[model samples]
Every structure is written in C-alpha cells, then in structure tokens.
Target: MHDRGRGHERRPVTQHVVVRWKAGLPRGRDEPWFLMTDLERPARRISEPYARRMSIEELFRDAKTRRNGFALRAVRLKKADRIDRLLPIVTLAYILLVGHVRLARRTWTPGRWCSNNRPNECSDFTIGPALLDQARFKPAAALAAIRKATEEVGEEWG
Candidate 1:
C-alpha cells in the first residue's frame, strides 16, 4: 500500500480499500478515505465500524482539549490506583458535559456567540466549546440552561 506522502516507501498490506467521501465544503474537492484492514468482513460492515470509531476518536479529542483536560492531566499522575479511581469520575463528567451540550443546542439560540461555522450541524463536540465561550461553565447554570431548553421543547428532564 502507498501512503499519501510523496516519496514514501510502499508497504505491503492485506487489503487497500477506498470509501466515497461524504461531508465537506460545498465546492471543495476531497479524496476518499483510504482504509487498510485485515478483517474478512464485507465492505458495508467495515464502513459502519470505521465511521463509529472515527466519531469516538473525535469525542476523545474534544474531551481532552475542549471539554476538560482529561488526557493532559491523566498523563501527569504517577499512581495507577489514582488513575483507576479518576477514570470513572472523568467519564461521568464527560457524559454530563456532552448531555448538557446536547440539551443546550436544542434549548439555546446560536445568537451572536456561536463558535461553529454551521450551528445547525453542531454536535456535542462543537457545542462544548461554544458553551464554554458563552460562560456557561458552572454546573448549576448549565443544568438550568438544560432545564430551560427541555421546557422549550416541551420535554421534562427526569
């Protein structure tokens, strides 16, 4: 298989697959994703898992940088036991942050403070930074905003 970089050595692989590009700028031209896999699964099955994995990778990227410094801080801790204990707390915080962002997107207006270029296409990853930018950093304020959003949607938060 040939890597995208010029003058790179060609490496042998079990399979080389190209999937059609889906999302991008309206007039922008982009290359299809080049995938190398060892699994014997059909192309249709492979695409689903690969797409899911990419979403998860994006989620982790947001958690580390935008939502919280989870990756940066975790690496500094010396104790394994502390790391184990910290994992659940960090996971819960991440879940709460994502949930809050999802709720806020439905409840709050993009107004003049939207960080995303396309607010309608915003997800938990995009909304988290936007929420922080809007100074909704406190848990109580965020929960209140979520409650307000749910109310607007005529849904109750249980």
Candidate 2:
C-alpha cells in the first residue's frame, strides 16, 4: 500500500502480527487485535507492553477528564515556557494522588462514590470518597467507632 503524507513518506512495515482471542461474552465472540511493530522481540513480548499501555492511557484520561483537571487547564496557556513549568507540577500532583489512592484502598472500605451500576466493573480511580472519609476520623478512632457500632448492633466486627 502506498501512503504519502506531508513532509514524509510512510515507512515500510517491519513486523505485523494478528492476535486473536475469544471475548469473554455470553455469545463467545472472537476478538482480533492487529499489531505492527519494529522491535525484534517475539509477538507475545511486544503484545504484553501494548496491552499494558491501556492502563497508562486510562490513567492519563482520568487525570485529564475523569478525576483531576490537569490537562484541561493547559489549553489556556499560549506560551511554551508556561506549559513546561506547569507539566512538572501536574505530574507531581498526579503521582501524589495515585500514592494517596493506593494507601486509601488498603486502609479504607470502598465508598458509595466508588459504586458502579454495571456488574463486575471496577474503577482504578478511588481516592475521592476515601480521602473525604479518612478526613473525618483517625485510623484508631475509626476502628473504635466501628467496634462500638457493631457491638451496639449485636454484631461482631469482622
């Protein structure tokens, strides 16, 4: 196939692989993925990283639109210098937020905000309510409160 573009010609295809798998659907549909790569590694090796890229993309999407307003404000900046300065701050904030979410996931229960109506759907973004709930009580105090409530309700804290 001939593909010409502005200022450049299309590079030759170095590697092409088609991966197929059965989709986990009730109808048992077949899902096919086409991957083109220039790396010397095996198809499986290249495909692993390609598959993992979805999570990275999701994280950026969450940071920009779903969770934090990181990239949304960048549109207003007309100067490259301002954008360069802002990127580091946004990246640092994203890292801190992810760290906080990981910690909160370990210590706290999933809140109402984390619930989705779709069955088996889970979210990587979970810091919102966890931070709010954590702010209301210390770990020890929260545990004590839970114990007291359970005792009063004639149920054991498990």
Candidate 3:
C-alpha cells in the first residue's frame, strides 16, 4: 500500500509498523489513515485473541507485585538471561499451584469467581473454615488428623 502520510508533517516513525487512525475532517467524517506494514496486520490480528486471554493478567500482576514478589530485587548483571532461564520454571510452578488451588478449594477463601484462589494466596498458609471443619472432628488431634485426612485425599483422588 502507498504511504498515506508520505507528505504529511508529523513525528518520524522509523519502525516498519504503522497504525491506522481516523481524525475528524473539516467537511464531514474523516477517512482512516492506514499506515501499518502488511506483516504487522497478521500479527495484530493473531494477538487480539491472545490479548483477550490475558484478562486475568492483573491477578498475576498482583501476585508478582504484592506477595513474595515484593522481595524480588533486580540484579545489576545480565538480567534478561537470568529471567529467560527462570521463566519456564516459574511458569510451571505457577501452573501447578493453580491446579492445586483448583483441587483444594475447601482450604481456600471464596473470591472473584467460580475459579480458584490466585497464586498470591499460595504463600498464605491459613486454612479456611471448611478445612477447619474437616479438621475439627479430630479435636485435640487436630493437626495430625488433618494431615492424615489430606494424605488420604491425595492418595485417593490425587
């Protein structure tokens, strides 16, 4: 496509990508200015669904920013390499914890939705009332009984 802003005076855009925008015209409705590279068009279309899938990103943001992540300090040296090395392990651990929360809902507080607790709750060890109820019958043997029952559950269902 021909560059719509070829002669227009504006900020210099060095990147191969261009965005289409519409501005009010003096006579009537303005036309769209298509400035995007052809390659970028497919990428933008593909990213739309992926971006929609990230609606829960805020939960991850809160966990990584508010909880145990607060203590995570930046390293002065080769940080991107370190992050590349650790990202998969971190992602796997997060996936596993999400699975755990889904299975162990009785031990968690009800929040957000029909889904499980966000990973921010992983570091929190407080057992909720329902789990406590399951823990209650053991009386003075509470801790041991809860452990045994949880173990049985793991063996049986997990």
Candidate 4:
C-alpha cells in the first residue's frame, strides 16, 4: 500500500512486516505471513493512534446498530458525500437525546442498554418517558416543567 502523510507527500517503500499466528487447543503448526511492506517512518507511529480510533467507531456502531438509535431511513440524502456529512449530525442528535435523558433522570447507566437489531422498530421502543420517569409523574406537567427549568438555568449560566 502507498503511504500518504498528512503533508500530502508519498513515501517510497521496500520493507515488510511479518506476523505469525499459532493454532491453539488441537495443536497445529505456526503460520507466518507478511502484513505490509513499507519504508515510511510515520506509519509505525500511527498504528497505535489508528487502533485507538476504534472506540469512537464502536460507540457510533453501538448507538446506531445495537441501541436502534439514530435512524437514517428518515433521511433522504443520496450521495456518499452527503451521507458522510449527515452521519456526524445524526450522531450529535443521538448524543443530545441521550444527554437529555441522563440529565433529566437521577440514575443513568452508562453502558447498560438493550440491543434492538430490528430496523422497523419504533423510536419509543428504545426510549420513552418511562425511561426518565420510572415512577409515574406526580403532575402531568412535571417533565415539561423540568425542561423549562433546565432551559432557564442554562441561559442564566451562559
């Protein structure tokens, strides 16, 4: 593969990375293969950074796929570039809704969530007022009143 740096310069390469895999349990001979061939200096350092990006990717996947949140079906973008542009906005909206729920509720589980793989499920299935108000609200306007109070506090703080 060609190595491209942040400065938009290409590097020549004549090196190979050798990796070995060994079979477990039943016992088998070790297998070795070259992962890549390169002579660029930056890639060696970038490997760790690239692996660290998986956490953010997994979060988006968990929110979109596992939690059945951030549905893109309602969006009508056609081009790949448009889809890429919309993904961040969709993710931000999902995060905002989650933040809203967490802040409104006293107890919020960070990682505990149900995996809803079905695409056609309603949004109510993933989130509802019951999620924030496990006990029935004392007054019909309690949620609305809390939201108004939060907005006033936010404005005052700003």
Candidate 5:
C-alpha cells in the first residue's frame, strides 16, 4: 500500500476479513456482530478469538464502572508503583468474585435470578450485577468465597 503521510512510501498490503455473525437464540431478535480481523484464519476461526475477547472486555467494564464494580477510575493513585501494588489486589478480588459467581450459578434454580432481568444464560458480563445482588443479602458469603479462592490458588501454587 502507498503511505501518503510517509511521502509516498510503499508498504506491505494488509488484509482484513469481516465475519458477519448473528448472535442470539432462534426465538430472540437477531443481534448481528461484524468481527473484523487481520489474522489469516478461516471465517469461523477468527470469530472464536473475538468471542473470547468479550470476557476481557467485560472485566475491564466492571473494573471501570462506578456503580457496578470496583470503580478503579475513582482511585487517586498517582505513581506507577502504587498503581502496580493496587492492580493485583483488584485483579484477585475480581477473579474471586467471578469464581464465586460461577459456583453460585450451579445452585441457582431456573427462573430464580437475584438481579438478572432477561432470565437468559448468564455470561461474565452479567456476573457483576449478580454478585452485587448477592452481596446485598450475604456479605459473609462473598468473604468466604474470596478466602476459598485464595486457598485454592495457594494449593495450586504450593
């Protein structure tokens, strides 16, 4: 490709593939997702990574949101060292919350959600709301879950 900004320098042509996907139940409204990637993979293969990205995106969203999860944006840490110290605590807490929610999900009865509005399958994005809902009624349980997750991690490490 010709780079206009670089005084007409010639560059290698990069290719992008757009995967058009309809994401929803057969009875639900069609949610179209256009996944664009430069990775040289089949259409079906490219979509898998994009699907996995939704979880990481959700984690970021939860970390940043003021009303939902730990609003890390509200923190006043100015130094890189302080921010580094804080990240592991926040990340560990987030992971434990997710682990707790996953365990909680197994016991949850059909159509008996505490915070979910749609009554649909819960994804990682939805876990923040569900965790908040449970924390309202059971603070001890949340603490216990965190301890359990810590112990599990310790076991794996040791």
Candidate 6:
C-alpha cells in the first residue's frame, strides 16, 4: 500500500508481515489480534516480539484503566520527579493487587460467569474488591512489601 496524500514527509513503508495472533490462548476463545511489523524477519519469529510488546501494552492498560485496574490515569502529577516517584508507588500497588488475585483464588469465592472456577479468568480487576475488603487485615506486611519494592529508589525520610 502507498500513501501520497498525508504522511508524505515520512519515509516509505515497505511490505510488512501481518498476522492474526490469538492472544487469549489456553482458552482460544477471544478475538484474533492483528499485528503488523517491518522487522524484515521470518514470519515465525515475528510473534515473539509482538508477544512481548502486547505484554507491555497490557501492563500499561492495567495501570491506567479505571474499570479494570489501578485507575492511575485519573491521577495528575505534573512534575517529572513526582511522576517518577508515583510510578514506583503505583507499580507496587498494582503488584499487590495482582498478588491478591492469587491468594483470593484459593480462599475467596468469585461470582459465577456462566462457568466454573477458572484461575485463568482471574485478574487484577477481580482482585481490586478483595484488596479493599481485606485492606485492614495486615498493614505491617503490606508496608514491608511496599518498602522492599521501593528500596532501590533511594528515597530516605525521618
């Protein structure tokens, strides 16, 4: 495909590999993923990079999305220093939520979604409520985990 109208200032894009990768594997029920890249490699090797890219993209989605994850998108931290600090804190919270999903899978009961218990279906979204319900259960451990995660940041206080 050639474009002569808009984006003419950019370099020409040569033929690229396009594939329909099934992201919801093990279940194989989700919609197909459309991936395109100009890596100039064999078709078989293309999915490797795409898979990693999708994982990273999903991480951002889980961090920013309001309905399913941390809802960090709503936060407004203008300064670069604040953003840097907030990222680590938010990441720690996200990790805690995902961790809750694992523990909740064993102890807490989930609602029926026309199917029986399937751990694959569990995610940070499902555990957000659990985190809130048990937020007061263990404060010291949560603080310890948060401090451990932020140790490399080198921020000291009294």
Number of the top candidate by TM-score? 5
Backbone N/Cα/C clashes per model: 0, 0, 0, 0, 0, 0
Write model 6 residue lDDT over 98-124, tens digit each, in one string: 544544454555543214454445455
Q: How large is the C-alpha RMSD of every model relative to the true structure?
A: 10.0, 12.8, 15.3, 12.5, 6.8, 8.6
Candidate 4 worst ten-residue window by lDDT:
116-125
Give per-residue CA lDDT, model 1, range 73-148, as digits (tens). 4367778898798889877676667656765666666653354454545446565655765545567655666666
Candidate 4, residues 119-155, lDDT tens digits: the string is 2122332553335445333333444545665686585
Q: Give candidate 3 misplaced runs (Cα > 4 Å).
A: 1-55, 68-77, 106-158
- lDDT for 153 (candidate 5): 60
lDDT of 5 by residue, 1-158 (tens): 43354677666666675655655543453565676555787776767656658756866877888866689899999999999999999876666666557556555652454343344455544564655555443546756766776686685344
- Whole-model lDDT, candidate 1? 0.61
Index of the highest-lDDT prediction: 5
* Candidate achieving higher TM-score, 2 or 6: 6
TM agreement with the true structure for every prediction: 0.52, 0.47, 0.30, 0.29, 0.57, 0.48
Q: Report lDDT (Cα) of residue 142, candidate 3.
A: 40
- The whole-model C-alpha lDDT of candidate 6 against the native structure comes to 0.60
Per-residue lDDT over 79-125 for candidate 3, one digit per residue giving the tens place of the 0 to 100 score: 78887877677555444444344444544454532245443332222
Model with the higher TM-score, candidate 1 or 4:
1
What residue runs in model 2 are displaced by over 4 Å at the alpha carbon? 1-47, 66-74, 109-113, 116-158
lDDT of 1 at 40: 72
Question: Which model is ahead, 2 or 3, in terms of TM-score?
Answer: 2
